[model samples]
Target: MAALEPERAKLDTTIPNESRIADYFLGGKDNFAADRAAAEHALTIAPELPALSREGRRFLRRAVRFLAGEAGIRQFVDIGCGLPTQGNVHEIAHSVAPDARVVYVDHDPMTVVHGQALLQDNERTVVIEADARDPAALLTHPGLTSVIDLDRPVAILLFAVLHCVPDDDLATHIVTHLRKAIAPGSYLALSHPVSDLCPEKTAKLAAVYQAQGTITGGRRGNLRTKAEVERFFDGLDLVEPGVVYTPLWRPGEETPHRPDATWVVGGVGRKPRRPREHPALT
Candidate 1:
């Protein structure tokens, strides 16, 4: 394990972090009072928050399994990896390919600590403390580079985290940088909250998150539309059934799409083997 920087080791229990609050929503006890308070408040707005969390996690597991089992992607760079939970990216990927490598990135100190503990014995996994806003910093981090091979196909997992990024241009830039760093045939699996599912409820919930000082609230941290979310996959080949609700994205069981249950939208896309040529080209 790499040595933790003093700055990254500090844990502030006063302010509620989105990752801890999310853990609270998922029924995890590794959270502070601030986290639970914020989660409770958010729940008042969107009553289905807990369900959304569970479904999002399930979507992550299924997506990772698909990437590893079917896509044959053995390396994963899971950005904004929330509190260490069961069946994480590495756990799912390694289950299919023991040699699979994963680098978990998050700005939360608790997340890093918990993730490090959970992945202690797993030599193929490494947890790095870094802000998701800076893809270059994460991509070039010593811990990540040690395990993840940029030259090979890597699955960039951006599950339920992009909303934390407030700036649209910055968010797009980060994705672009990461996509550019990876080789052809790499994959990107992402899930994000959408306001369109339950506009009223989501709007109210955004207020709760804002009051708690969570990253996304107000104009900065609200949910995005389906078309806006699709922009993240620019220049990539979306997998079949692209950009749909979590439950409907290649569901494991015979579950029908619930257009109303719109907390999250998720999909997988593959980087093409060759760059698209301009129409004016020969």
Candidate 2:
């Protein structure tokens, strides 16, 4: 537990942390009064916030399963991973392939503390504290590099995290770095809140996050249009039904149907292998 002091120092009971607020939305016990209050405030602006959070988790589960089962990905770098919750990346991935390795990265210190505790016994998973916006540093972090080999096919999970990376240019840089690092056939699965879904309400939600302040290590939140979100998948081949609303992305029969207003768009895209060059005219 000595290693947790750094993250513990950053904890403030007065201001709600994004990860803790998200934990509250997911009905997890890892939150404080400030988080609950913030979530309640968000509800007044967008009553479906809780449901949207759940739908986001469902999309994450489905995306991870698809990567592990169908895409044959054995290693994962899940950036901006929040607090440990039910059906986490390792659990979902391991269910499909027991040998899969996962490294969970987050900027929130508490998330790293809790995540580390959650996966301590699981040899296949490790949690590290790092900002997702700096893909270069995160991708090269010793904790992540120790578990995932960049030369091999890997899946980078950005689910529900990109919106927290406010700067569009910085976001593009993050994706570009990731794209350049991963081997061909790697995947990027992301879910971002879109403005087009419910512009007025979503704007209010963004305002709520902005007012909450960035007590954590990253941006509060930023709602992007569906087109803006789609651009994150620029160099990859989007899977079927690309960048659709969360529940609409390859939902299983059991996945509950959510209203279109939920507005969080998600998709999984694979980096295709570059074609080999032919020999010069011989």
Candidate 1 residues lying further than 4 Å off, grouped into runs, are 1-10, 216-221, 254-259, 277-282
**What's each prediction's TM-score?**
0.91, 0.90
lDDT of 1 by residue, 1-282 (tens): 112233532577877888898888887889998888788877777788788888888889889989999999999999989998777788788889888999999888889999999888989999999876667888889999999889989999999988766467777777788777778899999999987767777667666666666663224535677788898888889998999888888886746445467568999989888846512111
Range of the 10 consecutive residues with the lowest summed lDDT in candidate 2: 1-10
Tens-digit per-residue lDDT, 1-282, candidate 2: 011123432657677877888888888898888889998898888887778888888889999999999999999989888999988999999999999999998887788999888778988899998776556778889998889999989999998877776666767777777876788888989998888967878777777786676332234344789998898887788899898888788877855656556788888988877712312100
After the best TM-score superposition of candidate 1, give how far the Cα of residue 259 lies from its true spot, in angstroms: 4.5
* Candidate models: Cα lDDT each: 0.80, 0.80
Give candidate 1's total backbone clashes.
2
Q: Using alpha carbons, what is the TM-score of model 1?
A: 0.91
